[model samples]
Target: MLNSVNRKVFLLYPNLIGYARAALLLLSVFAFHVGLLRFAVGSYAVSQLLDAVDGEVARRLGQCSEFGAALDMIIDRVSTIALYFAIAAKSARAGLLIFLLLLGDVGGHWLFMYTELKLGESHHKNSAHLPPGLKHPTSEAMHQKLMIGGNP
Candidate 1:
């Protein structure tokens, strides 16, 4: 069933796992809306935990594909956005933090992916292959400088 061209794409194990995570995230949003705090937190945590394993499952099973990667990325970003939006709805302090986080996450990932594609590099390679002129730096050096507040 796994190899047959007639087999449904949704039936693939990795894709099925991704769909389950998405469902959990959706439930998390609904739970948060209904003020079921424990349920919301648990669902969201499980979704994220699944995220860490889905890629490995795909790689080990030889199921990796551009479509799978795109699906994973979209689900991850949407989940993060939904989770933070829900938190922001509950607390003003969380709203401020969420605003900053969403801005950096959405904007930074946009630039990062754009540059990665433009440079003909895979997303797995990190920013080490990035050219010097790029503004969105994710290198360890850049992070160290930011952490130290210095020109290193």
Candidate 2:
């Protein structure tokens, strides 16, 4: 079911899916804030699931451009942060936890990007063959001695 053909179909609908996900997330946040929407949490959860689906679809369809990945990541981060803030506003007592979660989320993304960049560079310089599943390494993994400075 998760084949390339299905993935391509999914990619073709990215704009629709992306917009729907965004709308749902916003609605969920608004509902949560208003205290009238009982299923706001469920809607938010569904949005998150759709976010994952869009990414996997893009990747499997060979539509995984850097721009697309970046866009998706940015959207995901923004939505998550917005939700965190919304919840924190509802309960001031959770402020510290929200702050910590935001810090971890941002820091983790930065670290991963940095490592990927380094690995990519290393792959380009040293490895002759590409990585089994990856298109290319973003940067060389300095810590791993096995990877030569070139493409592999």
Candidate 3:
């Protein structure tokens, strides 16, 4: 079913989808701040759906790239952590566990990204078409850059 649709629909508006996802994430945070916990949870779920759909759409449209995937992954991790923290605030025991879990998950993801960058695989796989300027000279360069407060 997905294959039959025109790819242009996805390609023409990836930025719009990204913005919508960001807005939804912001709304979820706002809802939590206002004590509408259920609404916040629902918003977070919707945001996740939007995030997944946008990536799938980008892929279907041949717009997939390592940069986009990395951005999406970072957003997903941050959103999940923020939402979990908000939820945890309502329950002491659950909150502690949630914090620990979030830390582990984020830490693991960071480690994997670090390793991939070191191996020079971060830019070679899904984003081989990236411009020369955007492509890292080598994995070592990427590792050094990342270690020195570079965006990854």
Candidate 4:
């Protein structure tokens, strides 16, 4: 087996998927730019689905790496921001709300990742510093609060 440090993680299946996601997002943005709404939505949706698969593929193939994690997050943030900006262009009033939400999304991710690096964490998802109840998004309490029709 190859040592972790020497592995060609960029070529790993998960990272390959990440690259594909980046390409798809690029296409998505271009499509949106040219007003090809169907193509934009289709590429973006497929990219999002691939994002869900990459991490699981990484775990199953023993290919998870910090680089892949960062790539995934970067692509995800870009996708979200691009979509938000497109939507924000519709109306000034609602655009402000969308922009604020986009700000929170980007700011929160940056803060979380920055803190992780500052604290020398091995994984971006490390939330041990948080209380047990809030350590995970899938936790029962969070699920109930976040699920559709559950609560605001």
* Top-lDDT structure, candidate number: 4
Tens digits of per-residue lDDT for model 2, 1-152: 57886555444645456767778888888888788566788777677767655555554565654445555566677787987897788799999999999999878866666666666632122234445554433232222223332111
Clash totals for all models, in order?
0, 23, 0, 0
lDDT of each: 0.71, 0.62, 0.64, 0.75
Angstrom error of the Cα, residue 8, model 1: value is 5.2
Worst 10 residues of 3 by lDDT: 142-151
**What tens digits encode model 3's per-residue C-alpha lDDT throughout 46-149?**
77666645555665676755546665776768787786778687777796689688988888777766666776764332345556665544334435433542
**Count of backbone collisions within predicted model 1:** 0
Range of the 10 consecutive residues with the lowest summed lDDT in candidate 4: 143-152
Ranking by lDDT: 4, 1, 3, 2
Per-residue lDDT value at 48 in model 2? 70
- Per-residue lDDT over 53-144 for candidate 1, one digit per residue giving the tens place of the 0 to 100 score: 56657766878666677778788789879967987887877867898999987788778778878887655324567565543333343344
Measured against the true structure, the TM-scores of the candidates, in listed sequence, are 0.72, 0.62, 0.64, 0.76
Candidate 1's displacement at residue 26, Å, is 0.3
lDDT of 4 by residue, 3-57 (tens): 8765787789999999998899899989988989999989987887777667667
Stretches of candidate 1 above 4 Å error? 1-10, 93-96, 125-152
- For this target, which candidate reaches the highest TM-score against the unseen true structure? 4
Better of 1 and 3 by TM-score: 1
Name the lDDT value of residue 57 in candidate 1: 73
